[model samples]
Target: MSPQQKALILLEKQGNFKVGSRSIPTPGTGQLLVKVYSAALNPVDYKIQVDGIFVTHYPAVLGVDIAGIVEELGEGVENFREGDKVLAHGNFYMIDQGAFQQYTLAVATFTAKIPSSQSFDSAATVPLGVDTAVAGLYGKHLGAGITPPWAKIVNDHEPKKPIVILGGSSSVGSYTIQLARLSGFYPIITTASPSNEDLVKDYGATHFFDRHLSASQLMVAINKVTDSPIRIVYDAISLPETQSVGWGLLAQNGILVLTLPALVKEDEGKGRKAVHTIGSPHLPHNNQELFRSSWGMIEKWLLEGIIQPNNREILPNGLEGIIGGLERMRMEQVSGTKLVAHPQETK
Candidate 1:
């Protein structure tokens, strides 16, 4: 029999999560069999537990952000070998690719080496947040369709235009702020609670507004900061209320990128676009070429501090700690940080 590993399993659809044993999976072509040291929890994990979304397989392991050591490499893999630390965006469609396990398979194209200066917990936070941010900015069909900063012909020129992000303190929002800075969107504005103002600014927001501000108030305030039209609004919150606010702030021919489904009514022929982004690179719908292009740059960016990993809150009891962490996320208690679990410490 193959070596077995302990994993947190969702017993059934909209069902309980429990630690169970499963055979460790093997790496396939262009894949790495990773011994996942740290797995970060996202809101989607809790949603999958209760709402039964994303996963099609029962008794499924559900985690998307993975950071670990390469236990073994499959055929045709060259960049990494045994014992190299790496982080990857796990695929939701395959149980073998999930992160809520002691060992899982990672697609090499979407994986990046973790810098020696970073911890597994910190690296675990990078996958989903960075992917969502880059995809929203650079993805041709699913995103706002802006030119990628990683493009070969792209210049360091910063656009004088302004952008507004609706939830600057959230993970996706924080990354969006950084990427928007990289794309040279000047006067980068965002809305968050007054308490998280410093956190948002630390992530590269040029201007921060209280999230309680009305749409009209935000527009008025933004006008004083930059005379340029707000051509892009990334709504990382994407709740109905936030969506309405972001949609209202978009200019003609502007793009409104949403992390959640669109809630606001789209007016016909106005040239405004509302796009819901799926951050998973392994998904069939996303631009795999764009994902590969961005993942290639992550290591250098991490080492240079050009990209910042989200602040981390590590949970106790190893993999078991993930359950309560996900509960806190579901209850809306977590803010401006990623909840991470050490699966290798599981008893």
Candidate 2:
């Protein structure tokens, strides 16, 4: 019989999450079996439970951000070995690949070594957040299609441009701000509560505004900062009001990138477009080459501080603690921090 491990299970569609037991899965070709130390929670995890949107199978384990030690390697896997500390973007669609389990399989392409300077909790906050930001900013179809920093033809002295990001404190938003800076965007304007101004600024936001400002007020504030055309507005929050503000701020022939479906209609006369993005690397619309190239650099970036992990708050009670953490996220009580659970600590 296969060995058993504890998992946070979603028993049914829109059902309650419970601590349960499941068999530890073996690694397949080019995969690694990781002993999960930390699993970070995202808003999507809670939304999946509340809305029953993604998973089709009953009795599923759901989690996407994982940080742990590789325990076994599959055939033809040469880049990683057993006992290497690593982080991976989990694929929750596969029951055994989810991070809620004590042991999960990670694809080699989506996994990276955790730098010595980082912890399991900090590394757990990176995978999904950074990948989502990458999809939104660099993906050809799902995003603004901007030239990625790693591209060969990218100019080191490219002209500076202006950008606006709503919800600068969110995991995706914060990563987007940092990538925008790397792409030579100037005056990286972002909106968030005053309490997160410093945090967002540290992530490379050059201008900060209170999110409570009306669309007109935000427009006025942004105008005073830059005269350049607002070519890209990333609505990381994607609420109706934020989408409206982003749509209104976009220039002719520009694009508005949204994490959720776009509620604002595009004006054909102005040629401004709104694009909804799916951030998963497994998705067809996400550029495969882009992620493959970028995932290779995650370790180096984290080591050099080019990318910063989200501020994380560790929850108690191991796998059981994830239930309360998801509830806090759903209630909008978790602010400016990612929630991480130690799955191996489950009893």
Candidate 3:
């Protein structure tokens, strides 16, 4: 018989998540089988359980941010060896690739070694959030088509340009603020609760505002900061009100990047665009190369403190703790922190 491992399984569409036993999967070519130590919870996991979105299979596993030690490598994989501590972006559509299991397969392209100074719990907070930020900012088809800082293009940054990010304290939002700073966008304006102003500023937000401000108030506040066109508005929250705020702040020829589907309609006369980003590296967009390029730099970035992981709160009870964590996330209780679980500690 094949090896077995503990997994958080979703029984069916819109089903409950339960800790269960499942056969451990083997790595295919160019993949690594990882012994998961830390699995970070995201809002999408709860959304999948309640809305039955993104995932189509029954009895499925759903987690995207994984951190652990590499146990085995498939044929043609050379960048990593067994026992190397790594973080990977797991795919929600692939049951065996999900992070909710003790043993899961990770594509080598999307995996990066974690710095020795970082714990597995902290490293687990990076993968999905950073990828979503990178995808929405640099992806030609999936985002605003901005030039990545790592790209060899002559004009890689817009030091004179201004950008706005809603939900600056979120995992995705925090990463976006960091990347925006790296991309040389000046006056990186972001909105969050007043309590999280320092946290977002630490992530490189140049200016901060209370998120409770009305759309008109935000427009007035932003106008006082910059006269330059607001070319990119990254709405990480993408709620109806937040979308309205973003849409209102966008300049002519600007693009509003949304993590969720856009609720705000675009005005063709103004030449503004609303882009819905797909963060999955496995997707067949023009973004595969971009993801690979960014993944290659992830280790160096983490080691050099160029990209900081989110503040993480480790959950109790190993795999069993994830259910409660997801509930808290669904109820909007978690903020400014990632919730990490240890699958290997499961009973």
Query: Local distance difference test, per candidate?
Result: 0.91, 0.92, 0.93
Q: Which candidate gets the maximum TM-score versus the true structure?
A: 2
Query: What's the residue-level lDDT of 90 in candidate 1?
Result: 92
Best by lDDT: 3
lDDT of 1 at 19: 90
Stretches > 4 Å off in candidate 2: 153-156
Better of 1 and 2 by lDDT: 2
RMSD of each: 1.3, 1.1, 1.4
The pairs that clash in candidate 1 are none
Candidate 1 achieves a global lDDT of: 0.91
| TM-score ranking, high to low | 2, 3, 1
- Report the lDDT tens digits of candidate 2 across residue range 92-194: 8989899998999998998999999999999999998899889889888889998898784656686789999999999999999999988888989999999
* TM-score of each model, in listed order: 0.97, 0.98, 0.97
Better of 2 and 3 by lDDT: 3
Query: TM-score for model 1?
Result: 0.97
